[model samples]
Target: MYDESVVPVKMESFSGVAAKSPISQCIKTVLGRARVEKRLTIGLLPAIQYLSKNTNGALFCLTAAAPPGDSATHMQEVLLQAFCAENDIYVIKVDSEQKLKKLLGFSETRMDFSCILVHYPYTDPFSDSQEFDTSVLSEAENDLIEHCETNWDYAQMPVIKLPEK
Candidate 1:
């Protein structure tokens, strides 16, 4: 997880000639400038922070641990992206390898991948805000968890036995 403070507020207008959408530019700006951290975000701490700060968004991260050359991780990313698309959410690929290691408490030898849903906090403009709707976010999170569980549970492992000399 990174510092929410550094994430620039959503742009009100984008008139650049570049082909990227405003949301893309916003995500790039945030990821490029936000401060990195050494703590794990397993409990969706970032999402909670966004809610508390009233940043008008929520963040959801999907971290997958896989063996070398496994395609499950890639498939999960695709599925998640589609899910985000259907929910009118913006998904960003988080490629901070060092930060991810700290976030997942893994050694450099492990292969992991992550994607984050940039702030999705919902608020009322006319009145004080209450709890944000996290149903879509929760569904996405549950899908990731279920995918990992299924893959890990069915994965084959080699067994070694001591020689009976």
Candidate 2:
């Protein structure tokens, strides 16, 4: 299995904490409880995992291209969906950050979700494909946990830079 150590981390919280705090740790502990076997608490993981592996009868979210015959969305969705076909472990996707960015935004759930398979669709070099598995990401995750080094040390985690072809 991929290193889960990537997700659990301790970030520095600015308020409501003593000089020695583990805001990130609190978030990670709580999130680990919420997550399912390699799945996030939300409904999207199944979707992403299915798409990543190109599962037959692949059910997709709102892609940039094709939509249902009755649905009137965009046109470039099919060509857009094949990018992260290998990272799918769940059958549905929720575009985690967007929903959280608005719903929770500055809430505690953000750090907890640090280990989730984040989708970087509109990033540098690429624009619209998903991005997954990163090193700096793992570092950030580590910063979100409570115990600090013992729980989120670099030695415990291995980073995988997914192919960007």
Candidate 3:
């Protein structure tokens, strides 16, 4: 059982771009039961943060770009948690981007996480914002890593255009 964060670190996210959620959704759609120790968030804006609990979990990162902010960060986390509860997926939240990176690089291949969510992505790190829109990333497309030999009948979709009044 690979316990390490399994999620990737700084995989080329932009100041205005996002990746984590799209990848999470992809894995959720692709692996389903096999997907474990997941990490995800849906910031206050239309953006989201996501991290799968495996080395190959990031195969579905960043389908499109969304707005940014700590509120967005908080919202993302809430949405992710709700999603996991509904699906019975194990998830963790990291507040500091740096801490999040550390877990991703955790030497232990398998270990138990303190909390289902880590609010700090980093210990004494810098910023935790996006540089670009996640939509530009390749993982945004139809690329779900083969963790389990199964398929998800109904996987979540990246936020495309918002609703109109």
Task: Give the per-residue lDDT of model 3 (tens digit) for 92-135.
Answer: 23233323223344434333221233121122225354232334
Span of ten consecutive residues with least summed lDDT in model 3 = 156-165
Give the clash count for each candidate: 6, 34, 52
Ranking by TM-score: 1, 3, 2
RMSD of each: 15.6, 15.7, 16.8
lDDT of each: 0.36, 0.30, 0.32
Error of 3 at 90 (Å): 0.9
lDDT of 1 by residue, 97-130 (tens): 4454453334354443343334433345465655
Compute the lDDT for candidate 1.
0.36
Quick one: best TM-score, which candidate?
1
- Between the candidate structures 1 and 2, which one is better when assessed by lDDT? 1
Reference-based lDDT, residue 118, model 3: 16
Q: What is the TM-score of candidate 2?
A: 0.22
- Order the candidate numbers by lDDT, best to worst: 1, 3, 2
Better of 2 and 3 by TM-score: 3
Residues 1-165 of candidate 2: C-alpha lDDT, one tens digit per residue: 433323323334333243232332333332343232223323234444554564332211221112247232222222233342332321112223332333323344434321133232122545354444333233323333223333233432322211111
Question: Model 3: how large is the Cα RMSD against the reference?
Answer: 16.8
For model 1, the superposed segments whose C-alpha errors exceed 4 Å read: 1-28, 32-68, 93-113, 121-165
